[model samples]
Target: MTAALSPSESELRETLAQVLPAVRADLEDLVRIPSVYADPARAADVQRSAEAVARLLREAGFAQVDVVSEGGAPAVIAHHPAPPGAPTVLLYAHHDVQPTGDVTAWTSPPFEPTERGERLYARGAADDKAGIAAHLAAFRAHGGAPPVGVTVFVEGEEESGSPSLTRLLHTYRDRLAADAIVIADSANWDVGVPALTVSLRGLADCVVEVRTLGHAVHSGLWGGVAPDALTTLCRLLATLHHPDGSVAVAGLPQGEAADLDYPEERVRAESSLLDGVQQLGTGSVVSRLWNGPAIAVIGIDAPTVAASSNTLVPVARAKVSLRVPPGTDAHAALAALTEHLRSHVGWGAQVTVTGGETGQPCAIDASGPAYDAARSSFRDAWDGTEPVDMGMGGSIPFIAEFVDAFPDAAVLVTGVEDPDTRAHGVDEGLHLAEFERVCLAETLLLARLARG
Candidate 1:
């Protein structure tokens, strides 16, 4: 049997350009839904967002579209059967978003998509809503009749840690099977530089409680003799890192990151690092960001300064977030962290560690025919610029689920976000030009995959 003819780069580019305006319009409509699935009060909005995504999939020429769930937030699934000898591709994105934090802090309303310069700003504009739009753009570019089979999965609760993703994947495993999967929830190297995320840090979190005194007592009565729980908890947290700011955990595993030239100036600018503050860890900037263990005290449960009294609190709790490198077992890292907390708190303070969540890290072997096709597509889309193999410090635990479920499939993590996208932050936005290239790249990827 003969393979399908590949579409020329110019042809794909022209098609994507023609369809981009309507795609942007649809994205604007989607961003306005306020589908913050993490917020219990926004459950109705999440449902509405699912319905809207299903409609878009149907409009994109998917004859079989359904909003299905497994006791979790709604997830939209759509399928286009493969032609003879053609491989199937699964496209993944999420329709949900993080809550609009401090709406007054946003230059524009979080749900109202606003255009500024070359970017569009909204809560989910760049994170995953643009992901859904990019999929639609590829389909429209192919006139809703691509050469290969395609499955679109727009999840509705990724922002909420995807608590039900496992059950949902189990329930709908057969429907999601494909030759290659494109997870459009990562980020690019830069605004004009494309990237394929080859690795991601895993996640482990726990709440540590420290108890010094059995009950609140007068600080003046036993100031130097007895330690307060809050102070003890702070000291324990301080032990998780060294004076050089590197993780001091005894047995957590680490990996080597790609040798990407991420300058300190760029990191400082992007992270908004305060003046004279030294960066943490002891490795290359990218290595520390992507291939090392990191621990941070995210939250502390204690008396507020405004409500404080001269009393030694009986108990204090803190939530710790840990990021482990790719290939490291998250549960083991969590265990190590738990052990460190229990053993390092001196003065015989009662230390109780409760593990919260664990997500396995992903390290892709980015070499295969499907990866070649994607690289070719990206290079063409970016005018001969090669796509970088990058690692994301953030964790997307569901990618490991996809790899486990479809062991034979080649998983590709792609994204529409640039450095300034500010995803999950106040001015979350998508660069329109880079987004166009992303759409074009996906369109070409379908054609190339079918041709082979």
Candidate 2:
């Protein structure tokens, strides 16, 4: 927690409001660069994004700011020493974003951020560029040189699996230490409703291929006898859930969040489910999404609707995604999911399951001194939006690193992106109004922490 020394609300406003425009401008500049990991063509753009953030930290009165390279993308570190006795707080946000798969679907160009309806339409705007810019707004507003000791960890490769963060933590744990960590990578519960992400669902990815015959047999020749790979794969996938649309996995337990915070109506609206298509999952919204396990067949290697070839597929493969409940061992879940697929063989079809890296989920301790100051700050930042509680379906593997390193640290995840923001999807955007409100909220957190 920050130390005590009162500053008037008017004073805080005077400090924060003046520089907001430039802060937003910087965010726009950040969104222009596409920072997809492993794309050699866009490596320079990611580096530029890294350098831009380092400059922001230096301007924020961090005497020491440098880009620490940890393999994939560089980690931006900025240090500000507090006046004696004040504690250190580490603010975390990512600099990179996912690849803009197709640009034609967007209303505006994906890289060229557009402003019209008080929202900035771009790739990184809501995801993390805005969140990273929010941290700068906080420190630059209250005191360019923060009253409390500060360490800013602006990571790259977050859109990727965050494979580099574990290495970064091990290599530079000393500099990353802080009493509490403020993670600005999550979204608000809804527009104008600020929410801290206390828990996140973990992830396990795999590629499953089912091989039936040696070649694509003509349907006319072997319609009845030919064992179809696609059909077999679908059958194995069908066993994942029961008739009630609940996961039927033998060991993975099922239950709802105690709060039952997210209502079904809200989830339906936010997810934009087709009106005619019935909801597939069972249990409460929180239970199905947050606590229980989910298996989604993301992509399939098969004939397209337009380019259909009337033949039996010799081999069928699917990129499958398995989301585990918070605190579930990812490898354990992966093994179970793999075994389930292998055991459900139909017509003596052979199935091969290959595993990929798994990202662990995080549940932060929000019952401490930091949470108290943050609740007050959130209220002050967003004109009394009455922030609700919500959990995310995605995972940030590095959040686990911080929790493990500083078990006692109050890890709070809040950001400008809201439920409908569409972070990793097509036509992604950020509300400019909410962006500044998040900045104000962050500003208040820093000021309240400084005055503690």
Candidate 3:
């Protein structure tokens, strides 16, 4: 790596290339640990991953590296001061991942990094561990520092709602100020395209419950008069969308987005969606994704047909997730959604809704220098593939917080994940070639930003 590297620029590329094995090794180690944020069994694993990130930053020439919070899973932060007049760039990634769901679905252990057909499979490997590795490699090859100032904000609770991120940002706004923030937690447009995430949708999560009776009763005696909470809840959920899949919720604000074709067939093919299911929603992909609202009934607590016999059930609960467009108020939207649910009663049953966090989304100004630098870097890194523009349906939430804190800072959302990369699912993987390319891209981006 050192031999191939002539100047600092080439040196960075060479170092990243040389360190690919080790980087992947580290990524594998990080992935093997189930750092599931919401689960009690994985809290310690999440904390350990945070400590590892902090250690990497410290060893890579960042003098000021420590966990910002006093208790719970720490928010890892590190400062790398640059030469005078250079603008600062804040780098952010998450150390935690969604749990290894349905272990039998994976060919290999979810934590063990295994290579098969150019993919490194593991939980969190694609979603974030690769992101962390790329950033660290870039920082390291800059000879323990970037020419421009850098402040790294790696989170420990992204898999969950990221409850601690906003607090940490508020607690350390001044120190975290930067001219641009790089969020490496999104997927690219596809396997070959280097995508610049221009926008992300806001989010709201809730638990919807229906309790019709004190307990279950014999269907033989109560079938005619008894109110079945589960059946009523299912009917209520059905009203959320029509047969065509468009949202049926009334009063939710929606606006047209700049057209992003997003072929329906392509989405279905890429996502491996069920065969016979029709595409839901209205208008284009960008519209349904970035501007309009979407509701997903993620989970339900009900007795299966096989398990249930002849009983009239009294309780039912379901998890609801909503993605709001940029500029939409999540709290207000939540109120509207819940109100809609309450109004549409199947049996005049009592309903309970437990609200979760409302995370706002962010949009980047692509004409800015930070973006220009990224475009060039990405083109070079991906063997001359034109840089692509896309928006994330999933929200990072911290981007909004970062913007509020650093009013003048530019925001960049580019990462190692891509449309082909299956994230948040079993047998998750990272493309090694793309990982190297992203590290190189960051190196070039940092160099350009430093000079400017």
Candidate 4:
């Protein structure tokens, strides 16, 4: 049950309303710069976004700000000392975004921030840019000097698997140490409701090559006798899943049942599934998405229909991504995936699987004082709606690193996106009302922690 809001809470909400316009404007400016870390051409733009975040931190009265890099992508680190006897908190977000694919699919330019009704649309608007803006809003609400100390750590290469994260964390461990940490890279339960991500699925990926033919031959001449590499590769990929779309890979750990019922209608609406398409797997939507193992062929090296000639290809390659639920070892899961692909190539096709990035799944224990404060603050910010503990299907590789680095600190996963935010999709957006609530919640959380 939610308790009544205190007098200070009422004042913070009013302050947030007054400062929201400026915060939204900051988000728009940051979104305008295309900061995609995956593309080498946009590397400078990613640095620009980091500089912009550093400026915002300085403007918000952060005592010390630095743009730190170690031969990879740069990160913005800023610190604000605690008001006597207050605990220090660490805030995490990323400045980089995913590459915009086929911009013609978007209603407006992907980098141009567009506002439609209660949503703000842009490439990075919801994913972590909104997160950066929320941190600024919380700091601005308290006149740039909160009751507790604050450390702002804005990463620059999160979308590209964060290859430099371990090095940066180790180098800056002393500066980033805090009593509590809040990762603003997750999604809310819904528009007006809040959620704390208590568990996250781990990730593993590989590129598999299949060679069925020694050389290309005319389809009309050898189609009947020779098996093309593309066809052979497709058959091998199909063996990873059952006819019902559930993962059929043997020796994988099964996921636990979800406490929340994710309705089919909501999933269809959010995922934008095609008409007449059936939902995959035989379980609740949350269970399949957040807990069970999922496999997808992210990319394939096959000729397009328009550019294809009627010839048997010699080799085909595919990029596969696998998501494992909490309590599963990521390295072991990758081994299982490699073994499954190697044994499933039909007709004695030669197969080679090479593993890529991997991160272990994480489950947070939300029973500490920091968590209690966050729950109370969220309830107050959402007007008596208690926050729910939810599981996320996506992997934040750095979350596990943060857990290992700061074992004593409570890590709270919060965000500004909702069900319809469509992060990393054609038209990514931020729900304006929910964003404001997120800002208010974080501000109140800081206040609550300071009281202790």
Candidate 5:
């Protein structure tokens, strides 16, 4: 049973209101840095972002702040000891942001935070930079001294698939140890709704090349007699899905998702699905999106329409991405994709499949006292709105790494994003009002955990 908020809660609300302006300013400063670790040109910017985060933590009353690296992008670690008999909590976020896709498509500059209506638009505004800001807000709301122990670990390469995460985890295991770990890099249910991510789909990708001939030939001469690599590649890709759009790959397992009311209208509105475009798969919309495996052709190595000629291409390549559901192995999923590509090709086309990165899916058991405290805190912050349990179609493989390195810690996947955040897409944004609630929820969570 939940109890009434104490006087301290009210005090915290007042304190947060006072500190929020500075927090938003700091968040804007953070969003201004193009810290895309995946881009070689932005390496220096990534380092700068890490340094800025370290400085912020130090200013927020963390006496011990260190910028560390594991042969990759720099990550910040800060510590504030817990009060006697209180549990320590670890806060996790990432400073790295995805590369802005097309500058012309943005309503404003991608690096410049702009307020339109009730949201702030920028490249890292919601994806994760707000996560860093949220942590700072909570820390400052307590006057830089909360009841529980606090350790902040802001990663710098999450957008780069966390290439050095395993090494970082192994090297900093002692300093990062905590009773509860909050990974603030997910999406909430909606603008005013809150959610705790209970499961995450894993990721696997590969490049498949199809060769139909040794050299390009005139299309007129080989129009009907010989197949072009591009046509053959298209045919092979078509085999990856059935008429109903479910994955046709063999040996893939289907998992279960939360029985939430995700109607077709909501899905279409969120995804911007075109009118009359039928939905994919046969099961519930949430199940297809969050539980079953999904495959997409992200990119293709073919001549552009403007550069096209009447020549039959000898070879063509396409990069395929596969989303593996919870409880499935990413490597196994990649193997299935590779095997399907090789077996489905006709006309004796030579197909070469090259594997890319793979990350394990994660399923969190959100039970016990820590989860209860988190739920209560969220409820209180949202004025009695119950938080929902949801699954993420995207992958955060490092969550599994955290679970593996610290088996006893209760991992809480909170979010600052709503359906319209557009993380990793053009015009990414964060809801101004909802962000305040996120800060309050996290601030209250730390107190509730200390009491437990």
Candidate 6:
């Protein structure tokens, strides 16, 4: 679908252009708050951020705004009723951000919003914080009252696995209900390009411990015959993938072909892969990343080399994360992973696998009136550039819940992050131009939906 810039569209663009500076300032203010939900010490900061979000929603003309907290974390809920027969759109974002690790590695402070060149750099700059800003900007552009009804749902515990989300959903089902949902917590296709995330891989994690000897022994005395737990764990982890890096786990389904071609050079640059290092798995880059299962050793409990002695360690543990493609049950994948780890320990070593969080994959049907409006709105916002149907390798566990809760609603997963955004890492940033386009797209989408 293509966009024709009618007089109304031009007026909306002008309004957004005039309000862009204030929106950016609001984003800067939000980035200044260190709302890290994963850190227990920052619980107050998370609540503070939620209050800020609630204030923003109220200032943006939401009549009913409340901070809902159910023992875990807070969420900002606001509603702007529709005019006549317009559809209600539930806009979702998160106020809490990922923990900023290794402050020395960052070019600037993670909580201090700084602008260099054409980007804004901070911890939550390109993540869901930008998502919140985008929604506010769009709402402001419409003079604080859009044609369509809007429900602003700004979550506060998304970075911490959203343990309270199910309870929140159940308690406030009618308040959060809508005909369409927009999750602004995903990635764009690239800078200056838009994408609709159609599929997302599910996530499963487990912590596996391997035990060999009862106690540490001298390496020289036991090196020839005794097996170390660390060595055994490493060998077992190696069996999770083939030499070509394809997943060796059974019962996991492969993903479908991606709609766009992800170039190797682009992937290397985006991923910051070292020179001469080969990419993992087979098939296209998108297919390997989004269409197939991937295993990652997230953390390991082993003695550091600096503190290590000439001794054989008795116990070792590793945290493993598995990404399952759409259509695969995450719980089943977790079971398979546990079974594989338990049965693969060599030298009769005892192995124990404990399951962690499991999230289901999501696949959306992007062929409906809502999707058509989104495509056209994006085309207009991006200067005639068409939005692509993309898939995200990472999992957003709450998307599945939102889909289940509002089965008939059109779920549009959009975001402000680009290939170089570096979200959840050091020197995270947001492309200013792309963020403006995102606001414009959302504003135009509301207009289109209202017209229909």
Q: Pick the candidate with the highest lDDT.
A: 5
lDDT of 4 by residue, 114-133 (tens): 99999989999998899999
Q: Kindly report which residue pairs in candidate 5 clash with one another.
A: none
Indicate the residue-level lDDT of 242 in model 5: 95
Clashes counted in candidate 4 amount to: 0
Error of 4 at 341 (Å): 0.9
Tens-digit lDDT track of model 5 for 357-425:
899999999999999999999998888889999999889999999999999999999989999999999
| Whole-model Cα lDDT of every candidate shown, in order | 0.91, 0.81, 0.81, 0.91, 0.94, 0.91
lDDT at 14 for candidate 6? 92
Better lDDT candidate (2, 5)? 5
Residue pairs with backbone overlap in model 1: none
Angstrom error of the Cα, residue 358, model 5: value is: 0.7
Clashing pairs in 6: none
Q: What lDDT would candidate 6 get against the real structure?
A: 0.91
Candidate 4 residue-wise lDDT at 32:
96
- lDDT per residue as tens, model 1, 1-452: 21222456567677888989999999999999999988899999999999999998898899799999888999999999988999999999999999988999999999999999999999999999999999999989988889999999999999988999999888899999899999999999998789999888999999999999989999999889999999998888999988999999988755667778988899999999999999997878888888888898999999999999999988999999999888679999999999999999978999999999999988899899999999988887887788999999899999999999999999999999998899999999899999988998899999988977
Candidate with more favorable, higher lDDT: 3 or 4: 4
Q: Each prediction's Cα RMSD?
A: 2.8, 2.9, 3.0, 1.8, 1.5, 1.4
In model 4, the worst 10-residue window by lDDT is 250-259
Q: What TM-score fits each model?
A: 0.98, 0.94, 0.92, 0.96, 0.98, 0.98
Off by over 4 Å in 6: 1-3
Q: Going through the candidates in order, what is the number of backbone clashes in each?
A: 0, 5, 2, 0, 0, 0
